[model samples]
Target: MLVFLNQRLVVFSTPKCGSTALEQALAPMSDIVLQGDPRIKHCTFHRYKWRLEKFLQIFDDTPMATTALIRHPQDWLGSWYRYRHGSWLDGTPQSTKGLSFDQFVEAYLAEEQPAFAAVGSQARFLTHPKTGETVDFLYRYDAFDEFEGFLEARLERQFDLDRVNTSTEMRLSLSAHLAQRLETCCEGDYALYDSAHAPRPKSRMRAFMQALAS
Candidate 1:
């Protein structure tokens, strides 16, 4: 999580999203920086809205312009699978050494997900559990240029993002059947991702209101 108090911008860290590179580039400009611990770094939108976002209102009491990136669901699980399959976690329960991507996703869809497949749900992370509100700005992970343009305009400085923390140990693909099942079961995940690409006239007004308030 990052807060640019002057800009009234809060950039949420969605796991397996390109947050590390953004943090490296934007940390110096942010008034408040939260990183290091995965939980803190990957703070959920709801947690921020209900807890920290409200707390920060003590300083500047207006709804902040928030932003987050979301990736395709199948690719997200692939990242988790490839990451845990690395040599570092070879012996741990979190290791995914022996499993194929299909099996890994199978475990993920299990009622009792094993440690290796316990990656948190992206929808839940970016949503208010009570009100079902998500971030103010949602962008597709693949279509990062649109977000970069927005940030450059907001921060008034052009910045380049470098690739970091990628999971390239192996390339794995999910079977078509399992992919369909994942899509069916994790409907919200797909919907959240789809929203990133949807037209957002309401969000533009929200951003306008935020600018006026600030």
Candidate 2:
């Protein structure tokens, strides 16, 4: 996660959403950059608002504007499958080397997911559990330029981002039945991505402030 104190912006790093590239590009310009562990590096918006932001209040009282990037659920799952299939993870329990994309996705949607398919939901990362509030800004992974442009304007800096931690390129296809199941299981992810275009609601802002105060 990258926090720009002057900008009052907190960019949550959503998995498989090109966050690594953004971090690398903006780290030097950020006031605080979290990159020690996966858990801390990719801290969720809800967690930061409820937990970490209180600590930051000693330094700054500025209400942070949270942002994140979200990808299509199917494509996001495909990235995880391909990433685990990489040579570095060849013999690990997280490896998806011998599995087809459909098989991987099936395991992901299972009641108890296997290690290789246990990636957490994007919706859950961005939403507050009790209030059902999401980040202040969300950008679609497919429309990366839109997000980049907004970030540049907000930070007043040009970004030179290189694609980092990209998975292997392959044409991934899911069976119709499996695709339907995935859609049903990840409906919240799809809904949240769709809602990104709308303005943040007053209730969401109120809930966020309440959470911060609590």
| TM-score of model 1 (CA atoms) | 0.90
lDDT of 2 by residue, 27-142 (tens): 99999999979999989877887888897887988788888898888999999998998999988989999999989998999999999999999999999988998888888887
lDDT of each: 0.89, 0.89
Measured on C-alpha atoms, candidate 2 has an lDDT of: 0.89
Per TM-score, the best of the predicted structures is 1
- Give candidate 2 misplaced runs (Cα > 4 Å): 198-214
lDDT over C-alpha atoms for residue 154 of model 1: 85
Clashing pairs in 1: none
Q: Which pairs, if any, clash in model 2?
A: none
